[model samples]
Target chain A: MKARVHVMLKDGVLDPQGEAVRHALGTLGFDGVEGVRQGKVIELDLATEDAAAAEAEVREMCEKLLANTVIEKYDIEIG
Target chain B: MKARVHVMLKDGVLDPQGEAVRHALGTLGFDGVEGVRQGKVIELDLATEDAAAAEAEVREMCEKLLANTVIEKYDIEIG
Candidate 1:
């Protein structure tokens, strides 16, 4: 199975990196981009074939290590 | 309009960050995670309602600054 995990900073949390990217974009002449929030995508190749199990396992991975639950949230897409 | 850009390193590129994350996962006892590739997600809030325009603009942003065309590929999702 394959899983893609999208990890994003939680709302209200400060994202210095994201802000930096936004600033860089403005400097590069890309206008009308009101806001930019940068997150992460983690692609995982698992050894299982069961979609349900893969999702559940990946969720555990997210909660345990893939994400910082205090400031980040993660969504898992299994295929 | 809103847009989400997924940027990933091209295959065969060295991913030290991804390797670090994978190592950390092993330390945390999450076995069976054979591989992990890390990328970035840029979420933009655009000032236009035209989906086509948003997509085009976002792609320009990606090519200009959001992603490094030499080693990174980006996918855009507009809504």
Candidate 2:
């Protein structure tokens, strides 16, 4: 099975890296970009075949290592 | 409009960060993780309303600044 995880900052959190991107875009003449939020995507290839088990395992991984739960939220998809 | 961009390293390229993550997972007892690939997801809030135009603009942004096309590829989704 394969698992894909998206880890993004929470709604109220500030993202400095995203702000840098938006500022750089403005400098490059790409106007009208109101905001930008940057996040991480991790794709994992697992030996397990059961989708449910894979998802559960990946969720645990996210909680334990992949995400900073206080500031970020993660979503997982197993296939 | 909103645009979500996913930027990933090309298949042949090496990802040290992902390798480190895999190693850490192993140390944490996450066995059976065959491989891991890490990527970036950027969400943009744009002032434009036309989805097609937003996608085109975001693609241009990816080509010009968001992605290092030499070793990275990017996908853009507009909504």
Q: Which candidate is the best by TM-score?
A: 2
Q: Specify the CAPRI tier of model 2.
A: high
Backbone clash numbers for all candidates listed = 0, 0
- TM-scores of chain A, one for each prediction: 0.96, 0.97
TM-score of each model, paired residue for residue: 0.94, 0.98
Tens-digit lDDT string for candidate 2 (B1-79)? 8899999999989999889999999999999999999999999999999998898899999999999999999998888
* Candidate 1 Cα deviation (angstroms), residue B38: 0.4
- Top lDDT prediction, candidate number: 2
Could you give the TM-score of chain B for each candidate, in order? Answer: 0.96, 0.97
Segments in model 2 whose C-alpha atoms lie over 4 Å from true places:
none
For model 1, chain A alone compared with the true chain A gives a TM-score of: 0.96
Give the per-residue lDDT digits (tens) of candidate 1, residues A1-79.
7899999999999988888988888898877888888999999988889999898888888988889999998898998
Please report the candidate that would top DockQ against the real structure: 2
What Cα-based lDDT does every candidate model obtain?
0.89, 0.95
